[model samples]
Target: MVSGKRIADVGYKLFSGSMMLLTVYGGYLCVLRAQRYMQKQKQLQLAAQNESTASETIKD
Candidate 1:
C-alpha cells in the first residue's frame, strides 16, 4: 500500500514531466511552422521578381 505522501509526490512528478514534454513539443511545432512560412514568403518574392523581369524583357 502506498502512503498518501508518496502518492501525491508521484502524481506531482508525473504532471510536471508531462507538462515539460508538451512545452518542448509545442516549441518544435512553432519552429517548423515558422520555417515553412519563411520558405513560402521567399518563393513568393522570387516569383514576383521573375514576373517583373519577364515583363521587362518583353518591353525591350
Candidate 2:
C-alpha cells in the first residue's frame, strides 16, 4: 500500500521533470528564433549593399 507521503513525492518529481523539459524546449525555440533573426538581418544587409552599388553605377 502506498502512503500519502509517497504519492506526494511522486507528484512533486513529475512536476519538476515536466518543468525542466519545458525550460529546455523554450531554450530551443529561442535559439531557433535568434538564428532566423540573424539570417534575416544578414540578408537585409546584403540587399542594402547591392542597392548602394547599383545606385553608384547608375550615377557613373
Candidate 3:
C-alpha cells in the first residue's frame, strides 16, 4: 500500500506540472496575438501610403 505522504507528493507534482503547461500555452497565445496585431498595423500603413500616392498621381 502507498503511504499518504507519497500520494500527496504525487498529487502536488501533477498539479504543478499542469499549471506550468497552462502558463506556457497562455504565453504562446499572447505572442501569436501580438504578431497578428503587428502584421495588421503594417498592412494598414501600406494601404494608407498607397492611397496617398494614388491621390497625388490623380492630382498630377
Candidate 4:
C-alpha cells in the first residue's frame, strides 16, 4: 500500500506542475495579443501616411 506522505507529495507535485503549465500558457496568449496589437497599430500608421501623401499630391 502507498504511504500517506508519498501520496501527499505526489499530489503537490501534480498541482504545481499544472499551475506552471497554466502560467506559461497565459503568458503565450499575452504575447500573441501584444503582437497582433502592434501589427494593427503599424497598419494604421501606414494608412494615415498614405492618405496624407495622396492629399498632398491632389493639392499640387
What's the TM-score of each model vs. the native?
Answer: 0.96, 0.97, 0.96, 0.94
Pick out the ten consecutive residues of candidate 4 with the lowest summed lDDT: 1-10
Model 1 Cα lDDT, one tens digit per residue, 6-53? 999999999999999999999999999999999999999999999999
* lDDT string, candidate 4, 5-60, tens digits: 99999999999999999999999999999999999999999999999999999999
Candidate 3 — which pairs collide?
A: none
29: Cα error in model 1, Å? 0.3
Deviation of model 1 at 24, angstroms: 0.2
Error of 1 at 12 (Å): 0.5
**Model 2, residue 56: what's the lDDT?**
100
Which lDDT values do the candidates have, in the order given? 1.00, 1.00, 1.00, 1.00
For model 4, how big is the CA root-mean-square deviation? 0.6
lDDT of 3 by residue, 1-60 (tens): 999999999999999999999999999999999999999999999999999999999999
Q: For candidate 2, write residues 1-60 as lDDT tens digits.
A: 999999999999999999999999999999999999999999999999999999999999
Flag the better candidate by TM-score, 3 or 4: 3
Pairs of colliding residues, candidate 1: none
Could you give the C-alpha RMSD of every candidate to the true structure, in order shown?
0.6, 0.4, 0.5, 0.6
lDDT of 3 at 28: 100
lDDT of 3 at 25: 100
Please list the residue runs of candidate 1 whose C-alpha ends up more than 4 Å from where it truly belongs after superposition: none
RMSD of 2: 0.4
- True lDDT of residue 59, candidate 4: 100
Candidate 2 global CA lDDT score? 1.00
